[model samples]
Target chain A: MPMMLDRRSVLCGGLSALSLAALNAPALAQATRLRMIWWGSQERADRTNKAIAAFKTAKPDITIAGEFAGWSDYWPRLATQVAGRNAPDIIQMDYRYIFEYARRGALAPLDDYLGKGLTIDDFGKPNIESGRIDGKLFGINLGVNSSVVLYDKAAWEKTGVTPPSMGQTWEEFAENTIAFGKKKPKPGYFATADASGLEPSFENYLRQNNKALFSADGQLGYEPADVAAWFKMWQDIRKSGGCVPADVQALDQQNIESNALTTGKAATAFAHSNQFVGYQALNKSKLSLTAYPRVGKSSPSGHYLKPSMLMSVSATSTNPKGAVDFINFLVAKPEGVDLLGVERGVPASTAMRDQLTTKLDDVSKAMVEYIAAITPEVGPLPINPPQGAGELAFVLTRVSQEVAFGRITPEEGGERMVTEAKRTLARK
Target chain B: MALHSEILSKEGRASALRSRGTFRRILERNAAGYIFLLPWLLGFFGLTLGPALASLYLSFTNYDLLQSPDWVGAANYVRILSDDPKFGAAMRVTFTYVVLSVPLKLAFALAVAMAFNRGIKGLTLYRAIFYLPSLLGSSVAIAVLWRQLFASDGLVNMALWQIFGFEGPSWISNPDYALYTLVLLSVWQFGSPMIIFLAGLRQIPTDMYEAAEMDGAGKARQFFKITLPLLTPVIFFNAVIQTIEAFKAFTPAFIISEGTGGPINSTLFYTLYLYQEAFGFFRMGYASALAWILVIIISLFTAFSFLGARYWVHYDE
Candidate 1:
């Protein structure tokens, strides 16, 4: 056996090393291989890989390897890879993260490639602009989405109360919720989630008053009084039983299956437009989407279509050109968008998106229609959230949870938010 | 006499050279053995020691993953000790989890082990059945199952309502109950130490128990006299192992809380918080400092356990 091993090593090992040397030689370089990564459910991964397979067929030499993980695991792994200078050639980005990465020079600029190897003619102007940072296109918005409130249609019908409309004021929403909440058998369910601890609601509320979550200088944009009033509104809603009690509702925040709408603890819950289908899958109730409670009289509805998810090239990519080519194919190729459909969000290609509408499943079509109705009213997208904007949601969640628990008043919560946001945003 | 001593010294030098030659011969003969140990040795140095020392250096720097680390001296430690409420909360949660889990797990393990030691039928099959949990309990599937089982309208609550005629809280999400549910899950996987206890039980000779019973001692007295004294070492071993494991608990809490350590951070184990700082917030330097602090805390507990062991452990038995 030892003699055989010696013979094998002598015979194959030297040849193997020779082959490896050949692989490393610049003259013998093979395909421009790229590693692309994203985080989502199995459906997104499946659709993404399918698009990739088609891209492989179109540009056979520019090969792409797909990698993915669930949301929480993806960031840490991606960060480690970036730190180690082994980041994937391309990564799926988020609105909150685009600035952090693009500003830090972790992502590559795609501005030069646009209209040359890549085309954005079919990709809408606002959608294309959403990915630009300081005039450099660091990412391509995969799809456009806006936040919406999802309601259990059957539950609303049973409540015997007049339901809310698309542009209902906060007061009107509260009154309608209380009427439903006061029905016999205690309604068993809340009218909606507490939503005090949710950042999107806070952002939209501030935006309704023409304020952003962060100023151009990266400071807290809204006045403390504005947030205080927002908190007080939720507090009033809770007092009227228009939502679940703070503690119970706090348990359901950001947890999909345990969310009040899915758990039968609420008739309505606030979620992204894309989440309506997911909520329906988890619950037996027939679900429908409506605009988030707006100012009713305001011209700008404080909602804007932002990239639900974005795609970016890593700064360390060896094959930047191929990476851009692959991304262009994913974004603009008819076959690619056709395979991806409305899974990520509403597709940016109006022609392809309109084509998808004809073949869409009921839930997906509803999401597309919901965004279409709200698009005209949405104000311009705010300065693509700030560098530490990803952390803002968590900080807001923590501070507002304190308010929900009654450990601090709304004013105090607002003050704490300012301090936390400043500290975090200062890191940028 | 000097000449004789010189001769002896020369002989000794010759023998020393011969011994050194023999040592080299032994090394040559044992090359295969060394090759077999290579993987473990490499892992010990590369995966364990390398990262540990690197983290010690990293703890002194601001190492956000995207950017290169900048030296911050003692800033991370000072911040953790002074103004970080989340750190305090994480420490409290960890201690509560560790303190509650280790003892309860051992107690459950000991009781089940004693029952199994009572000459029960199908011992091998029963042993395997009971040991299954320890093998599978730490898995992601089990954690997901735990989340579903503890939901407000889930199987556990439904069973309680049906059997006891009382409503149950959402055990997984309720802040007051969340940590304890994790504790219960930990206690449920007491199979490993139970197996160790079973082995310890087998070692105690039946003659000792028979002698105690013949002397008019009751069954309880026999257990106290012969069984308990001999079982101390196993108990000590199990306690130390379980305590260390408990301090490092992460996966279950991470899965159950869906990675945010939420329901108001009630389920945030120290490791989970360390993970959040390192990964979630991208504050690796603070996380490294937190990790070193955890090591010190665990070592102190271990030292205390050893000191206390002198009082109750009877190894001579």
Candidate 2:
């Protein structure tokens, strides 16, 4: 009797569903469907999908499809899709990519669409202007982020060593690292990953010393002596066994998850602050964030607040209006911001920042507070990197490895880097 | 057979003229067979040939993937051949890899095949167990496994320390040893070639071995004078295929190195570097140029093998 009832119920439900679909076919066909893509951890993707679900609930007329990928796979997948001229309606852009894509006319300009197709009235001027290429808006700033030193608080305690203070100098940090390494249980464990060619921290070091990675005209801005000095400092620490041996660290290829720090071979590492949250999630250790180690006798500040990632529309999107509306929902709406909180970084919109700061969790609140405290120390953001700028870090890593291995001296590696930098920049 | 010949004239005089669309006549004569072949032909033309031709065109241009390709003629080829240090390194590494891995893997495969060829119980089960790595190898997961196996604190080091009372260098990371680890990985997946060798071994008539035994030819003597000479054709086939496969090594290096081809570019296989140029650096034009060069190199190697085979490959014919 129960089986008969189940069969009858299934038949009746199927007939009603078919009739409903047949009745609403035209309306479904008329629905404005949009696609969006971004790259991050599963946590970010899940939070983002929830916000998009809210948008769906808020606007029944528009249907949205979403795709997300891990960081390493994202650029290749997106480039392939763009080359096929099938780019999604909305794309998540990095600060480094805005100029390249905008120059290529791949990103849609949002100047005319502001307050019409999209809304950025509440966004701060500095945040709004960052997306501009040649005085035209090409990306919408989603969040402002910066880099920090992520260290395991437990590791520090276990070593009986104090954390590097906020204004710790490079000399002091190296001494601290040596002390930390001495407390480790194993012979091979070190206090940190090798930091000679870690570009973000190296950039901060340069900036603190009144230099930048690239000049306004996209040339190597630092003197070879400056690069040599930076390399020498790390070389000294490496020789003192203050950091993981070069080959061991190179084994992991500087990926945050697999790096010596996360594998319990180090106490401190440099990463973007947004990644701090993700790092903590993977690293079961108690973690804390601090400013980049300062260059001795340099400026008081070296850090810059960077746009974590930005939202942009494809120039060739068929549903431009739908794309803008979705973008508007993501960055400007209360419902969306409520779900998103500060997962991306601190909100770029001033009002949203004020509203969400109090509601964040312990770690997220600490991230926001860390950024705010460092705000006074940070200088203005540097210009977006040039076309061939992406490969510069690789050159730095390759040659620095040579220095660590004693195949070349620091001075020679620095000169090699400068020469390679010039050759690389010339291609742009 | 009747239908196949029916399409041709008795005197075959039609071959002198009206040769255009001749394929259509042959195709129509065996329409059922043609229908059967349509899927493979479609795959060849649409999937393989189309991209291959497109890459040829791209090789002559400067394409950044973000913008339309700009024609640059021989500029890409000139740059890769002359200016790029990593290109030379990758070529050196790939050639070294192929030269070392091909001979080692084939030798191991043949040795194992001979071992299993003796009358052994559960022969089928032994063959299956040995072939498992060939089935599962070359996948990204297996590459990841190889990385863990060779890690500083991984099983390899543990074994070395416990059993040999020796410390192992980081196999996958140390610049001096990274390429050799990948070669060992290639050698480990010798099951496919071993199976082929086993088949070739089985095909040698038992009576020949009996005759050699009666003549008092020892095991090693028989192996050199009988087994190897007759198995040259299979050896040639396996060597050619393995060399080409080694030249295209990417996944193991990519997974093991985290796609950066690092430790001072020690494990930067040719395909990995090409992938980095095209996808990582957006230098599709240069990458396409590299791809074409790889094709030519492989083709030359295959041609060289076929040419060299005549003297050594003693076919029964």
lDDT of every predicted structure (CA atoms) = 0.83, 0.86
- What lDDT score is found at residue B243 in candidate 2? 93
Q: Please estimate how well model 1 matches the true structure, expressed as its whole-model Cα lDDT.
A: 0.83
Deviation from native of the Cα of residue B56 in model 2, angstroms: 0.9
Tens digit per residue, CA lDDT, model 2, A1-428: 54566888999999999999999999878888888999887888888999888989988888889999977888899989999988998999988767777888898888888889677777767778888887899988888889888888777778887777688888888998888877786777888888886888789889988889988877788988888888899999998888888777777555667877787777788888877777778788778999988876456568888888899999999888888888888788777876877778887787778888778789888898888889888888787676788788888888888888778899998898899888888873
User: Each candidate's TM vs. the true structure?
Assistant: 0.91, 0.93
How accurate locally is residue A178 in candidate 1, as Cα lDDT from 0 to 100?
83
lDDT of 2 by residue, B221-277 (tens): 999999999999999999999999999988898888878787788888999999999
Best by lDDT: 2
Per-residue lDDT of model 1, residues B174-274, tens digit only:
77788999999999999999999999999999988888878899988888888888999999999999999999999999998877777778888999999
**Which ten residues in a row are the worst by lDDT in model 2 chain A?**
A247-256
Residue A331 in candidate 2 has what lDDT? 80
- Score chain B of candidate 2 by TM-score: 0.93
lDDT of 1 by residue, A297-412 (tens): 66357788888899999998998898888877767777888888877888887776877789889988889999989988888878856666787788777777677767778898
- Which portions of model 1 show Cα errors greater than 4 Å? A1-28, A121-125, A184-187, A245-258, A280-285, A349-362, A405-412, A426-428, B1-30, B214-216
Q: Once model 1 is optimally superposed onto the true structure by TM-score, how far is the C-alpha of residue B219 displaced, in angstroms?
A: 4.0
